[model samples]
Structures are given as C-alpha cells and as structure tokens.
Target: MDDTPREEAGDEGAPPGGILDGTQEKSAQGGPPPPARSAPRRKPGKSRDHSAKRLANAGLAITAPTSRALGSTTIGGQLSAQLGTVAVSDTRGSVTQISYTATVSATNFTTTVGGNTSTISKPNISYWSGPATAVSGVGVFTPGQLAAANAIALTGSHTAFAVTSAVGNTSVSWNPTIIVRVPSSAAAGSYSGTITHSVA
Candidate 1:
C-alpha cells in the first residue's frame, strides 16, 4: 500500500480575493484612506458717492434808444428819457431769487450853464412792461417831484439775487421811465445826468 494522506476542502478561512462588494482589501499594513476633504468658501461687502453743480447768467438791453431829451416844466417838468428791459437766466437747476440796483458814476449832474446845483436825482422813476401782455406794478424807486440820486436805494444791497425757473418774461420785465423836474424857482440851464444800472 502507498503511504500518502488525503486533505479536506474547508481546510483554513475566508476566500483569498476579498468580500464580494468588490473593494480590494488593503494589505493589513496599509492605513485607512485620509478623511474626505472639501475646498474653503467666502462672502463679499458694498460702496458709493452723491453731489451736484451750479450755473447762472444775466443781461440788460435798452428797448428804446440810449439817447433821450427832456422838456422843461414851468413849475416842475417831468419827462421820460429812456425805456429798457433786463433778462436773467438761471440754469443752476434750483429756484433762485433776483433783484436790481443802480448808482450814478458821478455824484452830481454836469452842465454848461451852471449845472443845476444839485446831486444826481430824478423827479420820477416809473417801471412798466409790454403793451402786448404787460405786467403792471413791478415798479422800483419813486416818480414825480425831485427824486434824489444822492445814493438812491432803488438798488438792493445784494449784488447777486435769486431767479426762480418758473419766472418768464411774461411773468415780469423791467421798463423804467426816468422823469426829471425843474421847479419854477430853479436855475436856467441845460443839465445832463447819467442814470446807471447795477444788479444784485
């Protein structure tokens, strides 16, 4: 008889390849995979500016000629010398207020025949607008009987004034009438005085 021993099938342990789920078993020595890692995240903030600008302008025109003549009154004569208008525009984008003023360059009138011994003054300073669609009573200064130019205050203290965007020429316009007086007991001579305009 042969002296060889026979072996059984369930001899040792689990299958050599690994469990059926299919992840190859790590060698006993190798460590578990590093914990799952994910990228970092962030949140963001805000910014800005607010402001504005200004613009304005104005001008004067004599609707009537610059040269005017006056007639003498037996007692105190009154004559209209010149007629004119002023236009103001405000693009400043705000409601602005505007006013007018005037001054004589010379303190008094100068004439050939003993210039009337007096400071620059007028008898009447009347203001009116158009014959078409006039705006009445926007008057400045006084009229009739010895109006003084000895520093007249028809002019406002403010050099620059405000003009609202709503005001149109239809609303207001300047038409000044300068009247002079020569009392019966006055000097006999041809006198001349310059009426100047100043704005505020």
Candidate 2:
C-alpha cells in the first residue's frame, strides 16, 4: 500500500448525476435595492382668481332757442296786419315735421369681466303760455253797419282794420309768447319745447 490514503473510487448504488434546485442569488452589494422604488411625488394644488366688471350708466339732453317773433306793423296806417307763423326749432334748429326727437348718449361705460355696457334714458319737455290769461275776441258786423254808427277800428283782426286807439296797447299786443316748463317729475337732464303759429 502507498503511504497516501488509498482512493476508494467505485460507488455502485448512487443515482445518475444531474442539476437540481437551480436559482440566481444577488450579490450583497447592490446599493440597498435601488431605494425601494417610491412612487413619483405629486405636484401641489394652485389657486385661481375670478372677478366681474361693472357697467356705466347712460344719459340724455335737450335744448333750443329762447324766444321767437312773428310780424310787425307801422304806426298811423290803416292796414291789415298779418302776423306770419312762429316756429319752434329742435336742438339743432331743424323743424321736425312729425314731432320732436330726443338724443340719448352713452356718456360712459362700466367694465366687467364679461365686457362693457351702457345704460340710457330720454329727456322730457313741457309747454305753457307765458301769460296764461290772455284775451281773444271775435266780432261780426253786417255790410254798411260801420258807416251808420261810430265804430272803433281794431288791430290784429281777422278783417281789414286800422290800429286806432293806443290804450291797452300792451295787453292788445298780438305777440303770442310761450314759456318752457320743466316739471319736477322730469329726469335729470336737459329738455326743450316749442310754439307754432300761422297767419290767417
């Protein structure tokens, strides 16, 4: 026998050799498993501002001339006085055939988130005679009646007559005057009125 241990080689009862329970094992140094793979952080919520804009109010105005005149006469003359017509003008001094007109304007605007808007209204006008109490008369005379009696000629007459007596001239004056009246019920704005006349 050799001095080394003898090799007892032949094991006749072991099953045929083959691989079993195969699996991979990671190394001990893989940087803590990639920090446990946390889900991505969510962004913070943001705030928004919402506000509305305001709108402006609307307005209107009306105006015209102060006075108007008719016809004239010369003294010491027997004549037929025909006082022509008097007319009332509009704000632009243009006579409107149908009726008067008013202009409303958007003087300002109120702004909002939606947009700008305007409000509007109309002006009013009132009319009255300056002298509310004035005299009006009519006379009827037959032909040749004046020659048979003492009669007074008249001024501002529908018939042919001469201006004779100077008394009560101020009251007898044919100038028809009118006054513009604005009522308390009227809106906060300007207004206008007119007087119209005709010759007979």
User: Which is the leading candidate under lDDT?
Assistant: 1
Determine the backbone clash count of candidate 1: 15
lDDT of 2 at 106: 13
**What clash pairs does model 2 have?**
53-112, 53-113, 54-110, 54-111, 55-110, 56-110, 58-119
Evaluated against the true structure, the overall lDDT of model 2 is: 0.20
List where candidate 1 sits over 4 angstroms from the true fold: 1-65, 89-107, 114-172
lDDT of 2 by residue, 48-160 (tens): 32322111111111122223221111111111112222122212221222122211111111112124321111121111112212222221111111231322221121211
Cα RMSD, each candidate: 48.7, 51.7
TM-score of each: 0.36, 0.17
C-alpha local distance difference test of each model: 0.29, 0.20
For residue 199, what is the lDDT in candidate 2? 13
The TM-score, computed over Cα atoms with residue i paired to residue i, of candidate 2 is 0.17
